[model samples]
Target: MKSRIHPVSRPVVFRDRAADSAFLARSTVDSAKFTEWEDGNTYPVVDVEISSESHPFYTGRARVLDTAGRVERFERRYGGAVRPLR
Candidate 1:
């Protein structure tokens, strides 16, 4: 273990902008912004673009592309020959 080389980990707030959600956790990150949390204590606020609350994968809101259907439609319209793989 090194002595005093790493930044101090402290309580910080991560705010998910898309989901309007925030959570407190210890982090090595520093911020000039501050916000009062529900605990009635001020914590360094870090704005995040995406988090589990709003992410498509985590929220189950992702749109699955229908590549196979599109390919079949294209084959029907253009009659393009797709060579079978060996």
Candidate 2:
């Protein structure tokens, strides 16, 4: 047991830049930015690149990437399934 071992969790806002969305929740994360929330109170704001709002899995827009024919190149380099020697 220790005194004040846990960080303080306060009302914080997490902003999703890609999706242009924001949400408020309790967090201990620190931020230098502040924004006036819908309730007319200023809270610490943390900007994030992606969240459930814009994530492919959450948005049901998942995509498969075949960059520069890498998969094809690999297949051509090592054709067919590889079996181990007995």
Candidate 3:
């Protein structure tokens, strides 16, 4: 390992704006804003729009596509073509 060549890996707080959720983890990413952590040391803080806490998939709020309804509507609007199944 080379000294002074690699970015410092330290505890960082990732804040989710929409959900107002925050979590501390170690990362090498750089940021301008800093905050004092639980250890009484200042670390960079990164603001993000989405995280696992607020993501639809993780939260089980993901929308299921209405394919059946769409197909029916399409067939009703435009006559269904008869094509041989492959």
Best by TM-score: 1
Stretches of model 2 off by over 4 angstroms after superposition: 64-81, 84-86
Backbone N/Cα/C clashes per model:
0, 0, 0
| TM-scores for candidates 1 onward, in order | 0.74, 0.74, 0.69
- The residue ranges of model 1 lying beyond 4 angstroms of the native Cα positions read 67-86
User: Which 10-residue span in candidate 1 carries the lowest summed lDDT?
Assistant: 76-85
Task: Please give, for residues 1-86, the per-residue lDDT of candidate 3 as tens digits.
Answer: 88899888888999899898888999998899987777887889999999999999999999999999998897888765755599
Per-residue lDDT of 24-73 in model 1, one digit per residue for the tens?
99999999999999999999999999999999999999999999999889
| Candidate 1 accuracy as TM-score | 0.74
lDDT of 3 at 57: 96
lDDT of each: 0.95, 0.94, 0.89
Position 55, candidate 2: lDDT = 98
Sorted by TM-score (best first), the order is 1, 2, 3
Whichever of 2 and 3 has more TM-score, that candidate is 2
Ranking by lDDT: 1, 2, 3
What is the model-wide C-alpha lDDT for candidate 3? 0.89
Clashing residue pairs in candidate 3 (N, C-alpha, C atoms within 3 angstroms) = none
